[model samples]
Target chain A: MHDAVLRIAGLRTQFRTRQGTVDAVSDVSFDVRRGETVALVGESGSGKSVTALSVLQLLESTGSIADGSIVFDGRELVGLSEKEMRDVRGREISMIFQDPSTCLDPVFTIEDQLVEALTIHGTARSDARGRALELLRMVRMPDPETRLNAYPHELSGGQRQRAMIATALALDPQLIIADEPTTALDVTVQAQILDLIRTLQAETGAAVLFVTHDLGVVAEIADRVVVMYAGRVVEQGSVFQVLKDPRNPYTAALLASMPGAVAGTGQRLTPIEGVVPSLLDMPSGCRFAPRCPHAWDRCHEADPPLAAFDLNRESRCWLEVDGAVDGVGTAEVVG
Target chain B: MTTVAEQPDAGPTGGTVDGPVLEVEHLTKHFPIRTGLLQRTVGHVRAVDDVSFHIDRGETLALVGESGCGKTTTGRVVLRLIDPTSGTVRFDGQDLAEVDADELRGLRQRMQIIFQDPYSSLDPRMSTADIVGEGLAIHGMASGQAQLDRVTDLLEKVGLSARDLRKFPHQFSGGQRQRIGVARALATNPELIICDEAVSALDVSVQAQVLNLLKDLQTELGISYLFITHDLNVVRYIADRVAVMYLGQIVELAETEQLFTDPRHPYTRSLLSSVPIIDPELARATVRTPLEGDVPSPSSPPSGCRFHNRCPQAVERCRHYAPVLVDLNDGRQARECPEYRPEPFGLTAQSYRESELLNQGTEAGE
Candidate 1:
């Protein structure tokens, strides 16, 4: 296997609510190899975003990494001081968010934001402006020279995203964490941004951890995928293994539910028949037991560990545990 | 160019006329921009500029476009929630503009609208019964025990139960709240419903449930939906016909399958190509002809063709002459651009090829 740029094991992120504490992410593990893109895919309430935020230590005040080891570039980051983590954030790791409108300050110009990202990381002020302009050009921002002086509102949604990407790449960090970066933009503009990101990542040879709810976007960009259900990794494999022949019932059901997956119109989508369990009152056994179609009696009574079913492939299901791969096949047939 | 006068009158002008459930002709809705202390009209934002379409009984005609393309305005104008600056809307053989206040109120019983955000669309403090029964109360259709029973029935139809009648909007999940919104829209027994991005906010699994519910309702109730959204995948699944809108105009109108398999307009082709294919091999193999620049501002839109600035096939002549919707005689219509040509194979064919590759991969793995 290629050297891992970032390795996370047994990550547990929790938030304090008025009622009690809730585990937003629990016992999640993944690794992003050098110069490859790994996608964390799930629907809302699935903790994909929480996992991304936990990696960057950017969780809200009510949330914290209760347990985990986030080792990036051979260094542990679970309990780093704020001052030390700040030094590691922009220089070695950078992050992009879904909505650029909220991420970029409305009062600052694009040039000011990019330059600040560089200067705060100890780049000389004299060299920052030139590097900022180059970064904008690298992101393919139209009229980069004029766009530098424009505020966040002055740019379109797509352009604002480009500016955000420019800022994220200002330091040429070794790792980039993008959480639904193209989700807010229009489809045509999203195509442009995806192309730009793929090109730039190739040029820089940087590892990427992409978080998104859309499987279509994951198919377009990711090399490996980790499917999350509720607050745990239900499946992890290469994009083809996970998408085409999913061994996990949750992943298979998710693919079957997409409107685009069916061939023709008038075909009823195979919808998973229940809502996600509430975090405050989670089920005792499998997190997806209530909604899983192939779940048996044992599935409702015991929590399945994430066990390796094939080389570099893992599935969290009693079907894999009991050597009942035919159960997953039956689920696919029903789906 | 065929002007509004030259076009056939699809509207209901006389008695016993058999026409579409809703017909909008030359619809133009422009919001004037006021400036300075004078508050004078300086310019106009052409939100819905000379758009036209119709929804037949039990049919869905999706109006699709990116943000700021005036699709939402078109939906509102069709229902007369916002008055059009020009042109006419005819519903069930009666001109909306010609109806008096009393007559319009009576006519509104057969039309309803469902919004995108269930959180904001439903009244927070109102219980599910009150929210669903508001139309019955307003129209004097039912009252007391009868109204409660009807609300219960509507709830059951939308996959909710009678137990939810006492719950408020905040008590339900996003999907359940949307189901309540659907029940409220169905409460009036409306023949036509304008669903503006109704399923856009839900998760994929929940979205599938809602989409299936909408399809089932159409089958059972024979209701026509003017479904407005930018998601083409949803459009393909739900809409019978689709009208692709650009900067305040209909650029292409065709049957859903025809539009997907053989798009005639450059803008439509690019838009279809831009949607990410769910198959990894297909997504990588497809070469996208992406539109270059951002959409031009609606207030100061580009001259001639609104899409020419970003169109990959734009020529010098496209910079001078505005295009009109040209009927293709097979129930398909595309804007008259110099570069309009029919391709034998498109994105759908590309998808088929990739699926073939996937089947081979599966066999090899076995």
Candidate 2:
């Protein structure tokens, strides 16, 4: 638990479109350690997926990482070439996508996909088949023998998600990034998948970077949560701290927006007042300031940096932490 | 799709007590299927089976369930959007089930339906103004200057700007499209409007805004709503009386507050338990009774208690005799549980409380 497997410092991701360069992630930093599941959560386009892809250097060709120090096993990953990164990907650090049916090729059966993944990663055909069977069994796929021969389309949504998890765990990767893994499944099935992820994490002691918007899933699994709004980290803290006592306005709004929220009792939901501003053109002060109820006149002037917190909780906001000591100026906020 | 039944036994339409705006009695619709091309009625999908409920002059009656539970079919049948195979539908003391075709058409003007999907419900080629004013054209409500005036008024009532009247549905977002749907439903000045998952497509923020709009509209214009949705969270807040559906039948029907807090039906309890509360620690508080196995096809539903196969409380009676919607201990309460109100008298809440045994969830580790 104490071992820090991955540490990211001051990560910045940007997309240079025809209109202009838009900062998707700004000076964001967090760590995922052995046996711990850290959740990166926010609404759509809040840079949760971007942060995971940035660490993997798997961002779409048009998108690129502008600045950051990604240290895995005390080695820099930002400067690594495509060939070096390819070897590291799926072998050491793997990613399981949201929809496995899309990721799994229609032409190939479960047997073919699993065996091929093993062989490409340097394993003999017989050995790969043996290991693939084991992997299928590990994920608890019913009738593993018959399912190995069945195609992805033949399997249900839950079964396909399990197959994807099997593929991700095939190479014994140190870190696994799961992005909205259980969104497509039913509640009971979601519970099963979540339990599987937790069990796997415990057995392997592999670090996990989970990404989702469903607070319920996060509550069931996440140890710590990083809240993103627009293209920036608005709040970062322990699961208890972020969910129960969120200091950031955006985080609070998200918590309030959830259906059947007792906290939002008669208050006409002042839900993040406006639509998300286009990434091509952003506001000057805080990206969330326009929607934030707590935003003051001074907020419009400059971008707010991630202010240092006395505790582990860190927020990029103009809100005064500890009420007195202002280490940094009220700078320009991401537009 | 069927025609209204013939008269003589058209009961509720007698117009007693100045009539309920919409009252459905023993309503049932069964679709027959056959093998090969012989056209034999082998069996039926009893979509809405013996469903009976009434919407008061200005009260909203919410019908909620998971997919394929026949909730949408029930709502369509109520509006006469689809005719029921059997049972009686009385609207404003008029027996709709017995009413003739020309008479039903005239009554439809006073009863409108707002569909679930906004995109598919409206004509894509038509502009917003054309969409809203089409009803006026159809019923010959107004024309020329007066028609434009009514359409503009509806646009404002639904919170759309006057300029939006010129735009098509493609030009507006999902939330805006739903608002236009609401406006179209309102065009007829109908006393009863059925909103079939009206705000299901909208985002959380947008959903809240739409819900608030619906509440406001209800207050301003005393329109009764028959709201249908799969979202229990929304139902918990919006519904006055919720009827929990399973396998083409309402297993539980009670005041929203009572149903949510003290659910009698096992299906209702499990459905409520499955919802994810926002607060993490609180989310953990609800005793989870996870349902297993795929939902049985409505075509081949379990006999007796339709939910008995999946229900946690499947006793001997659940397999043998069908439970009737009878009065429970609570004066106004009615449930389809056999043990609820047993024979041999006026069983008060206290008497039944002593007799009925507590039930642990069906599965292990529930």
Candidate 3:
């Protein structure tokens, strides 16, 4: 396996609310290897976004990374000062958000934003414009020269996202953390963006820490998959291993819930019976036990660790521990 | 608003209605953009332009499109929430445009709409009972204890407990809140329910539960649905027929399976190919011809074919001659583009021809 571009171990991010402190991400561990796309897959409030935010140390004032080690490019980033982190942010590990409209300053033109991204990282102002134009053309932004002067609002959603990607790539960052970057886009536009990212990643050899709720997108783009539920890593494996033969009950149920997973039309989707438990009042045992059909007394009484069942395949399920066969048992559990 | 007693004798379900429950023809909605002190009309944003479709009894007809394609506008116009600039919406064989206010109100009881966001759609101030029972009281169907009873039944029907009647919208989860929305929509026993991206905001598990609930309700109540959404996967799961909209125009309309298997429109094919497949192998293997460029502004769409600019197979004729929907006589309709030729089975015409050439080469070698 290639060297990990970014490694996160025992990451526990917490938010201090008025009522109490809630652990948004608990013991979430994953790694993004060089030149590979690792998807942090989860539903809303699954703490996938928190994990991304924790890596960049960009958590809101109320939130903080309580514990964990985030090693980026063989350097510790957990206790880095804000000044030091800023130096690392745009130059080494760039981030892309769900909405490009909010990320791009409405007042500034695309050229100004891209040029600023370059200048902050020590590129000369005169040279930044040429680099910005090159980045725009690299991202396949339509009419790059014309779009460089266009304000964020003037550009279409796809164009704005392309500009955002260009800004992220302004310094040729080694790692890209994209949080649901294509969720807000139309399907066609999403496909285009996904294609662009894949192509650019191949060209630049930049590792992507892709976070998304859509499993279909994960399948489309990700080489590896890390499934999170209630701030815990429920499953982590190669895309085919996790998606085609998910060992964790939560992962299986999530797959079954998707309309595309089922055969034929109007078939009843095997839905997980309950909602994701509130972070404050999470289950004492397995967080997904309440919804898992295969959950037994052991599942409700003790939380299972993310145990490796095969090489490079891990699942947080008691069933996997008991040597349950792959594919067959998971299907029955979903049923 | 008059009481039910003072209202006319004609009710929505009073007569034996024939044909489809909802028939929309040439529905067009244009918002006039004003830019001067006098507020003079500068130009019209044609949100829904010459759109037409129908929903049969107990059938789901999904209006699928990208954002700004005007599927929601069509839904609103069909419900007469927004009056159409030019079109006829026939509900139960009565032209909605010609109907009086009182008549429209009476007809509205049989039509309900569920919005996408469960968070904002429900009144946070009102309890579940008030939210669900409001429609009942407004239509003069039930009141007081009787209204509570009906609301309770609706709650149970939509997979909620009777105890939830007194709870506020905030007390419920997103899926539960959506269930409340469904209950409120069903409170009036509406024949045609317009679900405008109803499950788009939900989690996958929650979405499945809600979709199953909706399907069960349709099976039981024979309720027709105008399911408007941008999610093609959901459309395939829920809709019997689909109308693919582009720049406020219905470019293609066909049965769900037929459309998926043998799409005749270039836009539909591109749209289908763009949807990320769940299977990893299939997702990677499928050749995707993703439509380039964002959808053009509805205010100033492309000259002839609205999709011409982004279309991969655009030709000279597509730029000058606007295509009209042509019936294929197989319960399907697609815009008549001369350049569009239906591919054989799953392969595109280009790839199929390449494979044929490869096979011929192999034969020659053999």
Candidate 4:
């Protein structure tokens, strides 16, 4: 296999709120190949965003990556100094944020921002504008000449996203992390933006680690899927294996709960049953145990480790530890 | 009769009564684009143009499209929140456009809207009780002890506790605030609701709860829903029939099952294909026929099919002649498109397409 561009091993991040520490992400890990798309999907508060931030060492002051390692280009990122990490960021590993409306600087022209990124990354003054224009075209933005002078606010929503992606790709980074990049875009524009991301990745051979709650977008471009729940990866596999035959109860419930997947439900959705446990008051066992329909005594007594789920997948469930294919067993019904 | 149980699970064919509770005929809303310091109208944005659909009592009719596709505009016009430039809106037996301001104010209780963003919709300064009870106070339905009772009842009905009444909107989560929004809408005891992306702002888990709540409320109260959303999943879950919109017009309208299983419109097919499935294998394998270009501005739409710019199967006819919304005789339809009739799959059906469409009508009903 080609060397993974960014590999996270046993990563964990926690937020220290007023009441207590919230395990926003625990024992989470994944990798991005040179030109592949890896989607991290989960409901809100599932720690998907925190994990992304942890990779970049961009977590808020109150948030901390409590454990594990982030290996970028075979370098250990966990112990890097803030200043050193900053140098690597945006040049070697960059991110495109969720809201296209606010991500760009309102005062800066698209040219100014892209050139600044280029200049900071050590491009010569004469080459900055040429490089910026090239990056814009790389993202498939139309009318590159006029668009370069436009401020983010003057550009349309899709234009702004294309600009954002251009800025991220300015450094020719190895991995580009996108957090709900299409959430603010309309469906048509969303289609356009996702296509732009895929096309750019194709031409540049850059790995994309995408974070989103909307599975619809995930299914469109993701080569691998990682399902998060309450700060832990409940299931991880190839998009086909996980989405077609979800091995975890949480994954199944989430699939069944979607209104579009099934024609119509004769019975109510087996919707995980309760709210996510507040991070301040993390549960003793599986954080999802309270709402999990298959939770048994083992689930509530001890936290399960991420183990062999399917041949290619891994799930943090004790019930599936023995590699059961039916996605159900006696231990699955315990608790 | 097309009953769900008695029949072979045909969608929306029914033992239940079907008649218009809400009828919109040729509705149009044009927002003028003002430019320069003079603020002169340079052009008009046809946010909703000659759109027509009828929501039968107790049924959920979804207006679905990409954002800015005019679904939200149509939802607002149906409630008369924004005055339509021209159209006839008949609610029950009354003509809504003809009603005076005073009479329209009285009718607000019969029609309500749940906004997309719960955070912005409710007043941050107001407590939950006041927000939900505001409708009751406006209609003079109740006050003081009665107002408190009404608000409290509304809270429980939306699956929220009465204790949450003292909390402000910012104090609540996105999903909780949406529940409060739903509670506020129900305070009027409205028979018809315009749900404008009500569940889009919520998490998947919380969305399920809210959808179930809407379903339970629908069955119990016999309320009709004009559900507006871009999320196909939620539409499939709640809608009885759906209208697929693009560039301020409905391209197709039909029962939900037929729309998903056998879509006639190319745009409709693309929309269904865009919906993400949970299984990764299917996600990878499913060939997505994604729309290629951005939706043109409403102020400057395309000459022919608005979707023609991005549609994968555009021919010369699609560029010159604007398709008109026409029925296919079968249960499903394309609101516009010359290829309105459904030909059979075989070579013989291709020879007599109109006859094939007529022949399919019985199969659709059965």
Candidate 5:
């Protein structure tokens, strides 16, 4: 595998709410290698977005990184000063949000925004416009000349998202964190955007930390998959390994619940019962044990570590403990 | 006549009416675009233009399209939530357009709507019991303990416990709020429910639970649905029949299986092929026939076929003349100009020739 571009280890983020200190992300670890897309897949309240925010150190005033290190390009991002981190944010790493309408300034033209991303990173004013145009063309936005002068509102959802991607790539950052970039788009437009991200990743060789709840998009783009459940990593592996044969019961239930394109119309999706519990008052043991079909006494007693299940796969489940006797019968535990 | 017994056995099952439960013919809804201090009507934003479809009793007929395709307008018009500029919406053998105020109020009980955003759709200040039982109170169906019992039952039916009745909408999660929305919609015992992107805002797991709940409700209650959504996967899973709309018109309609397997419209083909499959291998192997450009504005749709500007298989005929919906002998149908009808495999005449050559080569190898 290529050298890791971004590595997050033992990441624990906490928010000081009125009730108490809430642990948003707990002991979450993942890596995005050069030129590879690592998908952070989880439902809401699973801490995937919090993990992304912590890496960029963009959490709100009340929220802070309580533990762990975020190493990006051989430097620890955790303790960096605000001024220093600002330099690293757009220059080395860029983040794209789910809603393009909210992120892009309403008054400014597409040109102004793209130029600002470049110029703010110390690119020459004269050269910024040309680089902006080049990036826009790379993203395959139609009528680049006229579009550059158009406001964000004038562009369609798909077009605006393409512009957002262009802005993210303006400085040629090494790592791009896209949090549900295509969730707001239609399926067809989503496919186009996903394709654009993949093509750009290959050309720029930039590692992408794609955070989304959609499993279909994960299958389309991710080289590796990391499943988070209630502020912790439950499973991590290559895209195919994690999707095709998920080790964690949560991962399995999630896949089963998703309505596959090829599944017969008569097929009944197996829903994972219950909602994700609140982060403030999480379960004592496995966060997903409350919903896991194969959950046993051991699962509810203590949290399972991300143990190696296969050559390149890790699963956080009691059922993944090799040769260990489970609460149910003498069945050998296999991930 | 399309009978109830001949319907596809998937998702939900019950005996449908002889014809359709809700039939919308030549539907058109145009919002006036005005200007100046006087606010004189300048032109019409043709939100839904000459669209038509039907939903059978206990059947799910999904209206699938991009954002501005006017599927929501069609649904609203069917339920008479908004008065249509033109067309006939016949619900349960009564022409909704011709109904009086009192009759229309009664008809409202037979056709409810579940909106996409559960939080906003619900009144945050109202307790769950009050929100769910609002329909019953409006219809004067029950009062006091009887209404409370009905509300509790409805909540339980939608997967919420009775204890949740005292809580406010703000106390529930997105999924729970949606379930509450479902309970509210079902409170009136509607025969036809307009699910306007009801599950689109939910996560996949919660989405499954809700979809299953809808199916189970249909089977148990024999309620029909006009399922409007942009998510094709959800449409395929929940809809018995699918209608693909583009720029305010339905370009294709067919049984869900037939539509997904062999779509007969160029736009439908593009839309189907563009959906991201969950399997990495299948996604990588599949060839994409991407539609160019975004959906044109409904205010000023394209001259001939609204989809001609973005369609990959556009021709001179398609550019000059609009196509009417044509039945292709089988259960499938598509809106195509007679001169430029899609071939059996849904490819353009030019591409059909190329596919034929490829097929011949494969057959020879076999």
Candidate 6:
């Protein structure tokens, strides 16, 4: 039996905004297996970030988990009190936020902050400082001694991010939830950070829930990809299956729209025509129906369930139900 | 011709009838760091130093680099949005630096700029009609019904409706606002548009729409573009020629395909290797030539080659001898990194071809 670090099923997260109840995440189900990196990929308003926040029970007061269950390491996380959840957080599960500039406390030095993380989680007080140094070196922060004494503002963007990762690993949490960790950094620095994360994950064997919008980064680090669109899971599969031969039209459209070296020059990008539907005024049947090129009469009647075709492969689309996989293979041959 | 007298050298852009639409020579802009409350000059931050590139008529030349590499600053300097400490900006066979006030005002109509952030670039208080039509009115190209008609035409050209004229910036989505920005840049019927990370802020789907619109507009109007961005994928799609910047200098320049397939400069090679390939199989199979450490501060750039600090193939000569940009054969050029050799890094032709076939397979299904 595989060791699953986190298993979330039928999760529904809602925010009571002034306009109405915004269903940020609805009917999402996935799992993060131990020592595996699963990427939650989506664009803005896709609820990928909200799903991460919900997993950690770190949603704002205005938002709450309305349905489903988030089970972590054989323990239920839903309905846990803030104080009880706080104990579970950072001890068993840690989070690395998107913006490293704002994530760390501006007033505190790197050493003080990391020491606090170690000491708060029950490491003896005397050893916290030494542990902080070790953590800094682990992330390969150059001149760790000097960096430990400096504030977050003193470090560069890449350095600050490495410090953030070190802090996330301070407690040796079983799972790390990172939300667009390298989105703010330059491409060169982004590559380094991704490599660092991969190396550390291997050394520590911690399951990683990486949330990002960049499909390239997803391909680089993710073993499995969970594609979310407008608060719903559109596709879930191994990276190779989804990227090479996508079953869902939305996923295919996203892959097509991305400018790649293969497309080169003089290629008209296959853009999805419409904007993401608003949560308050969502479309009747499928939210992406208006934009999906293959959307048909069946698609306009009801939303498709996430159907499994192969092991660890599922796509939520009417075409998949109608046996379009063979048609795609034939189309490729004709080309 | 009159502008040439002030700069002395006259530069490449002056009195050349068949020259490129834009010619920039030895451009350098150093921001002085004032310190000690006396506001005395402490040191210089060499944001853009000795940078030079040109955009041909009806062509797009992309200036690409990481953040703080002076690509954006070069764009602003070419447009004269920021005054260069020393350089020559020649537009349409005339020097821009020595143009008189009246002549400069007239020259402004020929050059326009598009910013990266659509949210902040447009004034929230101004209606779309005023924003797009403001340039038309200022340049005195059209007025009254003609200006309104022109604004409507421009808006329609960019995929927005005439009904959107009355709406404010806040009312439009990010993509729509970017379209408005594009319309405003087109209001003056400019020969050259400086796009500084223009499509970087949009979503992938929206980015494609904007990119297609840009391509279509270029074909229709024959407008040249100084497309500045860090995204290589977009560069490969839109740019004809690309100049890669590092610290404050141009490290490499080449035709888009030439640069992508065979980058000679170590920095350019490292950058290309670092870009995460979309294909999971290809990405996993490739072994990247990792660049070491962060970019050095431009204010205190390393002696000789700025990239020497991070270059894996750096030799003893790279640390002392600052190499000049040298022209290679076949319309390709690179800064002389003497220690650098063309070693194939990341994603061989076989892997690239496989990924391309896979991508085509996805498209064939469509």
Candidates ranked, most accurate by DockQ first: 3, 5, 1, 4, 6, 2
Off by over 4 Å in 6: A324-335, B1-16, B340-366
Q: What lDDT tens digits, residue by residue, belong to model 5 across residues A74-140? A: 8999999999999988789999999997679999999999999889888899998888889889998
When superposed on Cα atoms, how far off is each prediction in RMSD? 8.4, 7.2, 5.7, 7.8, 6.3, 8.1
Q: What is the lDDT of residue A108 in candidate 4?
A: 90
Q: For model 5, what is the error of residue B312's alpha carbon versus the real structure, in angstroms, after optimal superposition? A: 0.8
The numbered model that scores best in lDDT is 3
Show where candidate 3 strays beyond 4 Å.
Answer: A263-266, A324-335, B1-12, B340-366
DockQ for each numbered candidate = 0.41, 0.25, 0.50, 0.39, 0.48, 0.37
TM-score of each: 0.93, 0.82, 0.94, 0.86, 0.92, 0.92
- lDDT per residue as tens, model 2, A1-335: 34677888889998887888888877788888777889999877788999999988988878988998998867789999999998888888988888897579988999899898889889899799889999998887767888899899887677888889999998999999998897766554576688789888888778899999777677778888988877788878888777777767777776665556632243344344556665766788888888777778767878787765746778887775434333222111100
How much DockQ does model 2 earn?
A: 0.25
B111-226: candidate 2 lDDT, tens digit per residue: 88888688898899999999998987887776777777778888888889789978998988667788899888887777788889887766566676677778778777777889
True contacts kept of 3: 0.75
Evaluated against the true structure, the overall lDDT of model 3 is 0.87
Q: Deviation in angstroms for A74 in model 1?
A: 0.9
Q: For every candidate, what is the interface RMSD in angstroms? A: 7.9, 7.0, 7.3, 8.4, 7.5, 7.9
Q: Which window of 10 residues has the lowest lDDT sum in candidate 6 chain B?
A: B357-366
Candidate 2 wrongly placed segments (more than 4 Å): A1-27, A53-100, A105-119, A122-156, A187-200, A263-272, A321-335, B1-18, B29-47, B80-88, B95-105, B113-125, B315-324, B331-366
What TM-score does prediction 3 earn?
A: 0.94
Residue-pair clashes per candidate: 0, 10, 0, 16, 0, 0
Clashing pairs in 6: none
Q: What clash pairs does model 1 have?
A: none
lDDT of 3 at B156: 89
Q: Order the candidate numbers by lDDT, best to worst.
A: 3, 1, 6, 5, 4, 2
Error of 6 at A162 (Å): 0.8
- The residue-by-residue lDDT of candidate 4 on A1-335, one tens digit each, is 55688889898887788877867888888777778899999988889999998989998999988889999999999989999999889999999987765568899999999999999989997999999999887887777889999988877777888899999999999999999998888765677688778888888899999999876677677988899988888889877666666777777777766654553544455455667776777788877788888788988998888886445688887677745446742111100
Clashes of 4: 16
